[model samples]
Target: MVLLLDGDDWLYLHPAMSAFDSAVARGEMPPVTLVFLPARDREAEFACRSELWEAVRDELLPLVAESGVTADPGRLVVAGQSLGGLSALYAALEFPELVSRVACQSGAFWWTPDAPDRPDPLGGPVGGSLAARLRERHGLTGLRVAFDVGEHETRMLPHCALTETLAERAGATVRVSRSASHHDRAGWRHALLRDVAWALA
Candidate 1:
């Protein structure tokens, strides 16, 4: 199963499902269920909090299992962009049993615990709280993660680069790449598909 955060917009505006089907047809990825989950309040939910991860573990996964999708519990993939991307990595770190594969695009790596209230949220740290967490944690041996950031997102690069390096250092099987556009969903669309496929592989 692939749990996609901020996926409602991606599904509606882009031909994401079609692209998935095409990739499957070409033997690029296995046939799997895609769960597009929309966040009610992105700021609160995707802030790398326990509440969001708990809801996913307790409520969402059970519902998805009840639906009888041909999903492998051991190979679950989580894909997200921006803040959603941050949340995806957070899940992998905090709930490793639930999330082991991740396809993250342009994660908000500058997010500290108190970043939302700061005058300049991105100015506080190089890679923020996540980087510190990654530095301290080293249990990512079985994790498979794909990290992608837009090539044009210059300001976001340092944070992303630092986080990516730290994740790799933590022993995750990591794949890094750059997208063509800036901090936009259009640029992330293709990377989402490609990275998910790689994660599954």
Candidate 2:
């Protein structure tokens, strides 16, 4: 399992590893090798860019493979929140072999190629660029994705809902849910663990 966010926070602030271990102890899910990856440039790296995907596919994954971690290459799960969530789905759409399963929380689906330049980034078209891409793509038959967004994030719901519908329409086995809080990570913690397990299952 690859977790995208601050590594220290994921390890300390949240009991992600402990929760996973407990679930495994209960036979709720299989044991997984957790890989935490923090973003170097939040805006640039997390954007739907080919370069970032290339680097992960080429450099980072090779390093992980060389580390002798006991992980199934074919069953890799990528979990991310907000912008990272968008990037995780991007990886699944662009490189399905590398990222077939994903657990996304509160994805910034309002991101477009020129969204940053707009006065209100979130005020752009629904589902942003990813929606447009999904409308034209159709190779997600093997993908399994779980999408969770905060219930209080009213502005984000439309974008997320459209994207979820498009992904499922394009052949991905998708799961959708809503958390109790806003866009904050604290509210996403439980969903992260639960959704990851669902994706793995």
How far out, in Å, is residue 112 in model 2? 0.5
Tens-place lDDT per residue, model 2, 1-201, is 554555556877775778788888988778888887767687898889878778877887778879886345468888888998999899888887688998999999999989999999999999998999999988688999999999999999999999999999999999999988999878888888788889888
* Lowest lDDT 10-residue stretch of candidate 1: 65-74
List pairs with backbone clashes in candidate 1. Answer: none
TM-score per model over all chains: 0.96, 0.93
Q: Show where candidate 1 strays beyond 4 Å.
A: none
lDDT string, candidate 1, 39-100, tens digits: 88998899889888898889988888788864464699999999999999999999898899
lDDT of 1 at 196: 95
lDDT of each: 0.90, 0.86
What residue pairs clash in candidate 2, if any at all?
Answer: none
Q: For each candidate, C-alpha RMSD in Å?
A: 1.2, 1.6
